[model samples]
Target: MSSAGEAPSELTGAFIEIAKVTDLGATGESETVVGNTTADVSISKDQTNSETNKHSQRRSVRTKTYNTLDIEVPALLVPGASQLETMGVVDSDGEEIYGDVWDACRIHIYDKEPATASSPAQTFEFENVEWDWSEISLPEDYGEISFTGWVHGAWRRGKTATS
Candidate 1:
């Protein structure tokens, strides 16, 4: 309703966003965190570009803030899977990390079971699984993403004492 004569229309669609991982450990080629219906992975690699001289170039890593960036992830109707809601920056110690240029990439998967599980619970089921990675947007600050307040409870069991 409006003062004079106006009408508001309803919108339908899921909300998604991309966040830059501000911090992460300086070492390790890849890291993955599995959830009930989603899995987030981050890959680190050395980067060299003409814009930045070889010595001046810095190391960069690809990290997913959330396993499922899809708001309607569950609506996808995949069985034996849940929806991923949030994602945070990776924990980096501010060291020289490297990966293949352009070719190398990190992928987020929505597996049926959690990756931390000893083994896949069942042989196979109608677990809805989908994956996609948003582009990385680095910030001006420098620091490895610490798991200080990061949420790791996307699974039934809770975050491990040490990530």
Candidate 2:
């Protein structure tokens, strides 16, 4: 709540990057998306938990910190590029001989300006991530390529050091 008559502030200038590599390496036209979720939860919510259901005023401790963010991903490995290209399995015609799987994926979250020599920008870095594209339901609804990410590690929130 805002103090007295103070206006409620909003946060902006935040961005996210999705990559096929743990280091977040890729190149191409940044993919753009328009995300619209009618309703959802960022983390796991188990209502039967004794602590949250009975002890914590209907708040679940299991969902206190989300290892995920729902920001627009902004882009992918460029249009017309196959998953094999993303996995570095492209052939002469840029085709994958076989499907590939990821061992480790990375996501870099920057709420403020990216790392610079002078100022420390606020950022969130997910070391290892597992992500997938959601299936689109047909006929009655518009088709969509939904991106869902699962981050694994401590909740790291701090200023980014200058590179």
RMSD to truth, every model: 20.6, 11.3
What digit string (tens of lDDT, one per residue) describes model 1 on residues 1-163?
A: 1132211111122221112121122233232322222212222122233332355558554453333211122212111111111232222443222211111111233223333444332211111122232332233342112111112212111111223
Q: Can you give the TM-score per candidate against the true fold?
A: 0.16, 0.34
TM-score (C-alpha, index-matched) for candidate 1: 0.16
List residue ranges in candidate 1 displaced over 4 A: 1-27, 38-72, 75-86, 89-117, 121-163
Best by lDDT: 2
> In candidate 2, which residue ranges exceed 4 Å CA deviation?
1-15, 19-48, 51-84, 87-120, 136-145, 158-163
lDDT of 2 at 38: 20
> What's model 2's TM-score?
0.34
lDDT of 2 at 131: 48
